[model samples]
Target chain A: AQSVTQLDSQVPVFEEAPVELRCNYSSSVSVYLFWYVQYPNQGLQLLLKYLSGSTLVESINGFEAEFNKSQTSFHLRKPSVHISDTAEYFCAVSERNFNKFYFGSGTKLNVKP
Target chain B: DAGITQSPRHKVTETGTPVTLRCHQTENHRYMYWYRQDPGHGLRLIHYSYGVKDTDKGEVSDGYSVSRSKTEDFLLTLESATSSQTSVYFCAIRVLAGGLNTGELFFGEGSRLTVL
Candidate 1:
């Protein structure tokens, strides 16, 4: 079974300040990592995913996550945050070829302007 | 929304009543999922369908049942409403043919149901 842990439950940051959201996973085999954003009352939208390759994955919205095998972590980072970035972020993990997903509790990113 | 919509965007129902939430998607994706969102738990899968009439239970499928009669529609039913069932529900879809290469999934806006 694979599981994910999002280190922080809530993170408050000022606009334009760099922010990082920590995520870690526990699995016996290969796994895929994903970050999703949920605005207020909306469903989750895919922010970014790390399948394989450079270890660092980026989203079109200036968010990035790095896959660290040694640390079993995939932390999300943004150089400059905006108030619009305020939302509930989730980290999820799925084993290779599996349909079931394991999710972290979630982190509420409160970007104050 | 990825051509996916959930009916009854917000609802407040009394306990012990029956409720059924609908999810419609025009994308024709082969995989459909039902998830619930709460304060700290994030999104938890309640049920999922791989194809019409092919359904599976998820982590929190205890009091929920799902059915899919067509390709575009998936329904979640609560046998008897309970206060614990009150939360925002979301429906998501993913293409099956793409295999694991499908990087992301399309999500519906969401349906907020409150059981009073």
Candidate 2:
């Protein structure tokens, strides 16, 4: 079974400041990585994903993640954050088959103005 | 939007009561999944259905059961609800495009259940 570990439970940052949410996974086989964001009182939405190709994957909202095979980590980062980016972000991992996904404890990104 | 809907957006029930949550999708996706979200536990899968009448257990399936009779409907049931079962439940459908699994999931708004 694959397990995901998110190092930070809460991250507080000022608006326009850079932020990073760490995520690590344990799996023996090749896997896919994903980041999902949940706004207050809303369900989660796919932020971005890493299937193959380049190790660095990016989302339209200025957030990106790098898949480091050696570290077994896929950490999400944004050069600058907005108040709207304040949400709970979850990191998930699934095998190549995409049969099931394992998620981490999640990190609450609090962007303060 | 993937057109996923979960019933009873919010419910308050007592322990030992039977609870059923329904998930409906308009897209006729082949796969549907149930997950529970907690404060520090993130989201844990309870069950998943690949096709009609073909379901499988997930990591936290000890006290949960699921049934899928139609491609658009997936149901999660708790035979006897417990206080520990009080959590927000989400239903998701796998994104399949061009007959390929996209490795992306579309989630529902979630059903908040509180067992007191």
Candidate 3:
């Protein structure tokens, strides 16, 4: 079984400030990582994903996450976030044989104007 | 767009009553999934379908059932609705085959169900 841990429950910051959301996963073998975002009362939307690649993957919206093998972590970072970025963020992991998916509790990113 | 739509956008039901949610997609995605979101918890998969007539249980499948008889429609049923089942339900689709697979999921707006 695979599991994800998002230590932060909430993150508050001002507009244009840099932010980082931490995520950790427990898995025995190679796994696929993903970050999703959800606005108020809306369904989730994919922010980015890390498959078999250069440890670092990026989303067009300026969000990036690095797959750290040794640390068993994949954290999402944005150089600068806008008020529009205010939403809930989630981290998930799925293994090769996993038909089901596991998601972390979540990190609420509250961006203030 | 995921081209996915879930019917009964909002509903209020009583406990022990049976309820069914419908999801329709036009993208022809190979993988379709059902998830629920609750405060303080990330989305949890209730059930998922790989292909028509091929479905499997997820981490939180105890009170829910799902069936896929056609390519574009996936149905999720609550045998006996409970207060605990009162939450927002979302349907997601992903194309796992061919080069069209982006590994990214497309989600519907979600169906809000309140079980009294």
Candidate 4:
């Protein structure tokens, strides 16, 4: 079985400041990781994913996450965040087969001005 | 976009009343899933359908049922709604374009159900 854990429930950062959301997972087999963001009153959207190769993966919107195998972590980071980045972020994990995903509790990121 | 839509974007019902949510997709994807979102719990899968008439229970399948009679339509039903069941529900489809297994998923706008 696979499970994800998001260390933070909420993170408040000033606009243009760097932010990091920690995520850890437990799985016996190789896994695929993903980060999703949900805006107010909307469904989740894929922010980035790590299927294979290159431990680092990035999204189009300046968000990136690195897959650390030894630590079993896939933490999301952004050098600079904007007010528009305020949203709930979720971390998910699945086996290499990608049959289903196990998600974390979620972390609410509030980028203030 | 995947052209996925959920019906009854918002609904209010009483306890013990039966509620059904519909998910429709135009892309004719092979997999459809139903998930519920709560404050602390990110998203918990309720039920999923692999094909027409082929449905399976997810982590939180109790008190929930699903039906899929067509390729593009999946319906989730609550036998008897409860207060705990009041949450936002989302629908997702797995994309397998051109025989490539990208493991990408597209989500619907979501349906908010309030059980009192």
Best-fitting candidate, measured by TM-score?
2
> Which 10 consecutive residues of model 4 chain B have the lowest summed lDDT?
B97-106
lDDT of 4 at A15: 100
Tell me how far the alpha carbon of residue A46 in candidate 1 is from the true structure, in angstroms, after superposition. 0.9
lDDT string, candidate 3, B7-35, tens digits: 89999999999999999999777789999
Score candidate 1 by lDDT.
0.89
Which of the predicted structures, 3 or 4, would earn the higher DockQ when compared with the native? Answer: 4
Model 4 lDDT at residue A113: 95
Compare the candidates by lDDT and give the number of the best one: 2
Off by over 4 Å in 3: B96-101
Residue-level lDDT tens digits of model 1 in A20-88: 999999999999899999888677888998888899999999999999999999999999999999999
Could you tell me how far off, in angstroms, the CA of residue A93 lies in candidate 4 after the best superposition? 0.9
Worst lDDT run of 10 residues, candidate 3 chain B, spans B95-104
Task: Output the lDDT of residue A98, model 1.
Answer: 46
The lDDT for every candidate, in the order shown, is 0.89, 0.96, 0.90, 0.93
- In angstroms, how far off is B60's CA in candidate 1? 0.6
Which candidate would rank higher by DockQ, 1 or 3? 1
lDDT of 2 at A92: 99
Instruction: Name the lDDT value of residue B13 in candidate 2.
Output: 98
Q: In terms of DockQ, which candidate is stronger, 1 or 2?
A: 2
What's the lDDT of the predicted structure labeled candidate 4? 0.93
Error (Å) of candidate 1 at residue A94 is: 1.5
In order of appearance, the predictions have TM-scores of: 0.94, 0.99, 0.95, 0.98
Supply candidate 3's per-residue lDDT for A83: 93
Candidate 2 global CA lDDT score: 0.96
Query: Mind giving the per-residue lDDT tens digits that candidate 2 earns over A18-109?
Result: 99999999999999999999998888899999999999999999999999999999999999999999999999999998889999999999
